[model samples]
Target: MNLDFPTVMLIAAVITGMIWALDAWLWAPARREVAARKTASGGVSKADLKELNKEPVLVEYARSFFPIIIIVLVLRSFLVEPFRIPSGSMIPTLMVGDFILVNKFVYGIRLPVINKKIIDMGKPQRGDVAVFRYPKDPSVDYIKRVVGLPGDRIGYFNKTIYVNGKPVPQEIIGPYFQDEHPLSQSAELRIERLGNGEHQIVVEPGASLVEGQYIVPEGHYFMMGDNRDRSNDSRFWGVVPEENLVGKAFMVWMSWQWDQGGVIWDRIGESIQ
Candidate 1:
């Protein structure tokens, strides 16, 4: 089974809080009164009473960690959440081992795990880099740029993108090169400008994905990786449901170089477009 740390933290917080609340509201007060009565009646020894009312080890640990766990849960569920990039689908924009902070409430405030948005905060726009629960397998999380909004016709052919029968502007910048790539050695790079959001993308000369024309379904968003030739995204699967939306990736707090030593300090603290 996949170990979901967020869910574990939430469960721990609830269990610990429950035990502590019960003690504070009912059990602790009753125990203190019983102990006092016993002492007055000379029925129980002081040492015995103290030991009897002592908390269990599990409860003690829980009480110590409950506050921290709840704080994290609340912050991640409603405000922001941290995620580590594990793949190179979002190359140039995001890298493997990149620790990014996603704005949780940008799209909307959703219940964690179930991911049902209760608030109508805002809608996603074109060129937004969004993290979401993968439509093919909701258990997995995927990150991609929003290419097509609801009701727009999206098409990918001849290594170019089209929306609503109009071609999305692209300007070739030449071959993409990196010291050490997590996915590929090299690819052609370009700048794609969709409205005010302009971002870099890379495509292989003879490479192709599940490229085809698709009419974006209502309440769904078409997603694509910056590494166009290699991405396994909406092109291969399907549109991401609005309910599956997680958050918009806003910044990179840290980036690590696994093949080499230490961090890629330059990429750290960079704003994600």
Candidate 2:
């Protein structure tokens, strides 16, 4: 099953919080009062009092984990959340199995499941690697680099990007090769100078270019994967609505490859562009 983690967290927090609240406000007070009356009426056995005071297992677990679940819910919903890359569409920057940390509050804090933004903290930049709810399937979270802001004219011709009629500079760095990794033999690494900093992109030379011109609408952003000619992004579908944005991905916390058989420690703590 494709588990919706944020929804699951919200549900857990609510159920456990309600259980704790009920015990605190009604059940525990009633039990305490009953014990007090029994003690005053006669010599109530200590064992009888202990038995009355003992909490049910489910209630105990709920009480113990309520705080933890709430803390996780708040942190994940407003502060930061972790995501795992499952595809190579962002290869050379975000490899498959890369565990990334996204800054949630930087973009804005939204109500978890509903995802309605209550505050507007900042806007997405042209070069930000952002995570957002997929427009086609809101339940799916997609990661891509922000290529065009609202009201910008964007064009892709001959695998080169043009912003406002000017070509966004992309220079061929060289043929990119991973030592003994034969799967990525088809593409070359190129440096694309975006806003503030430059990042590497994988491009298949002589591959069929998916060219198009688009005018970004207000309240939306254009997105594209770093792997040119191999990405299913705005070029393939459509622009990402601002409301669907989740957060900006900033770092790779971990990378694991089970098929390749182990943790890739070298990619740990790597900063994402």
In model 1, the worst 10-residue window by lDDT is 178-187
Winning model by lDDT: 2
lDDT per residue as tens, model 1, 1-273 = 775767788788889999888877887788788778878888687688997688767768878889988888889999998999998889988988999999999998888656677887899999999999898887888999999999999999887899988898999998888777843444788899985779998888666456689999899999999988778888888899999898999999998877868698998899999
Going through the candidates in the order shown, the clash numbers are 0, 0
lDDT of candidate 2 over 1-273, digit per residue (tens): 565888898889899989888888989898899888998898889999998777778789999998998899899999999999988878789988899999999888899888999999999998999999999998889999999999999999987889989998988888876652333466788899887778989888768877989999999999999987678999989999999999999999999987667789999999998
Record all residue pairs in model 2 with backbone atoms less than 3 Å apart, i.e. clashing. Answer: none
Top TM-score hit = 2
Which stretches of model 2 miss by more than 4 angstroms? 1-3, 179-186
What is residue 143's positional error in candidate 1, in angstroms? 0.3
Provide the clash count, candidate 1.
0
